[model samples]
Target: MEGPAGEKVPSDNQVKTFERTATGLVREISAFRTLVLDLMFTSPVFMFVFAILGIGIFVGADMVVSTLLALLIGFTTAGMYALLSIAYPRSGGDYIFISRILSPPLGFMVNFVFTIVNISVIGTEAVWVSTMALGPMFSGLGAIMNSSSLASYASVFSQPVYIFIIGAVVMLVFTSVMFFGTGPTFKIKSVLFFVAVFSVIVYIAAIGLTSTSAMISNFNHLSSTSYQQYSGIVTSNGLPEKFEVVPTL
Candidate 1:
């Protein structure tokens, strides 16, 4: 007999120790693909804001110590998952692995909660990518390149309707990519790896090549505001020149 995926299915169990023949999912994704997915999950584009949030909360924390601690935590967690993958090399993800290895009830509870969190993350991340990432990126590029057309496009992106449309399109595109299959999804992510690398290089170059004065000049050119006026406004409404802990729980 043939299984749904066209793989041959045994009519009877040959091994006396086994209860019966059962169809098992074939593992399709390679180790390299899994590594790529892991890299993309931890990529700066998705994670940079969280890193900033950590800094914000732990203001004046020792950078070296913080980094080492984070590395230790990440390494241990990643190692656990890596070991799990090695033990269960099937297409079935965390839910399947957990259910098979542990109690089904516990696995179900975990997967249920995870699914709920993932739904919220997906919606919010879509909106955030459009508004926070894309909007600022286009605006900054327009400012840097002095492109009136790009600036106009950025203004269009500022509207709620346009932002929603772009976010929906992004969500739809990714959903479709996943629905098609893992192979195509893996290829697309591999391409995005290059794009992410290029973005990081550009970001570093922008920081290294441009000075504070140049940035101020660009802002002035775009906003028609002088550095003195900007400084005054910042002083009036922003953080104090000297750092002090704000009242918080």
Candidate 2:
């Protein structure tokens, strides 16, 4: 074909094959490691607090049963993700799978929205981690040292500007680590995963060793105080007149 400048342009047959380079990442992660990563992605430790606030408050006694049910549902969802991973076997994951099997337009729309949401949420997550995790750890150190001022210093993270700055710094650090390569990133993640898992196991063991009656009594006492404080707001919203604790063993 003739170019705009009257130069001869190469036809389709002249096109060269694009070569894909080796990323140098070995498939070193084992099944257990993959399971831990997947589980961490799906159900992070932060979600424990969310579940407590969302379901545990009302279903205090039955929270264990509710959690078990949720775990069953999570397993089913994880199975679906596994199937998709096997079918696609690519990094694009759900987007590529859906685009190949279904319509590209639908896949694009789904992924585009998801990408936007995910990107937006990273800032929130960074801010939360800084304020909730780091702040608490610093405060705990302050407490151990018997310095109230040091503990109060954590309040700086609660400021909007400081939160944004810290979140941005966190994003930059992680992004840099990822740019360096997955090896270091995964190593850090693995360490964090083990620590989180150990913490969760210890927490669960403590809960298991506690007496059921004691738990119920504590829940009832807390609920009674909260109910009295928020009864007016609850009634205005057409909620229950009183907080009722679930009766489950």
Candidate 3:
């Protein structure tokens, strides 16, 4: 298309360049799906659930008040996520949101804080994973070597040194992976994502079935004893005045 004043208009080449850029963006977005799934699988949800269960067990409440507290906190966190998404609706996340809400200086400061927190979280995760990986090896070392003299000296020297070495190794590996860029990182993460999901499903199924079976056996024994005591066949300690039936799903 040309203007009537003999001036050259935007040509097909310019249009083609814009289209190519758009196509590249679409391809990148499509490729990111696996990375997103990987993140979802390795998320904090599992740790959060385990923490809540541990708290409930340790608190020893008949009705588990910690469960309610967890629910409330979860709801509030979800609401915050929703609010942030609605407000920003962009890729850069809180940095963009803060910039929109306040001055650039404030936004940069908030972004710096977010970066620090994110790095700290990454460091913590690396430490936790290293602990899980090396705990068995350290325990084995302790068992083979008596703790009286040699083992004690070994433990004292090895603990901090091993931890430091592990931390350094983890950091180096992660840094190398990151430096390689998103493509290779995403590929490895995709495999880890599937592994994490499969592990969780297997763990949950095993624990759930075992717990249910144990509960059913205990319930049957309790019911039989209650029946015997009610019929005046034998004396039972702490018999309920009235039997209450609880439904299990």
Best by lDDT: 1
lDDT of 2 at 230: 63
How do the candidates rank by TM-score, highest first? 1, 2, 3
Positional deviation of residue 102's Cα in model 3 after best superposition, in angstroms: 3.2
Global Cα RMSD, each model: 6.6, 8.9, 11.0
Residue-by-residue lDDT tens digits, candidate 3, 84-133 = 76654333356666666677788889889978987887777566544544
TM-scores for candidates 1 onward, in order: 0.69, 0.65, 0.55
Q: lDDT: which is higher, 1 or 3?
A: 1
Clash list (residue pairs), candidate 2: none
- lDDT per residue for candidate 2 within 56-171, as digits (tens), equals 35543455565676778878977887777765453436667677779889889999999999898788788887677777676766756767787786776667888888888989
Stretches off by above 4 angstroms in model 1 are 1-24, 52-68, 86-93, 96-102, 208-249
Model 2 residue runs over 4 Å out of place are: 1-33, 55-63, 88-92, 138-147, 210-249
**Rank list by lDDT:** 1, 2, 3
Give the lowest summed-lDDT range of ten residues in model 1: 14-23
Task: Report the alpha-carbon TM-score of model 1 versus the true structure.
Answer: 0.69
Which scores better on TM-score, 2 or 3?
A: 2
* Candidate 3 to truth, TM: 0.55
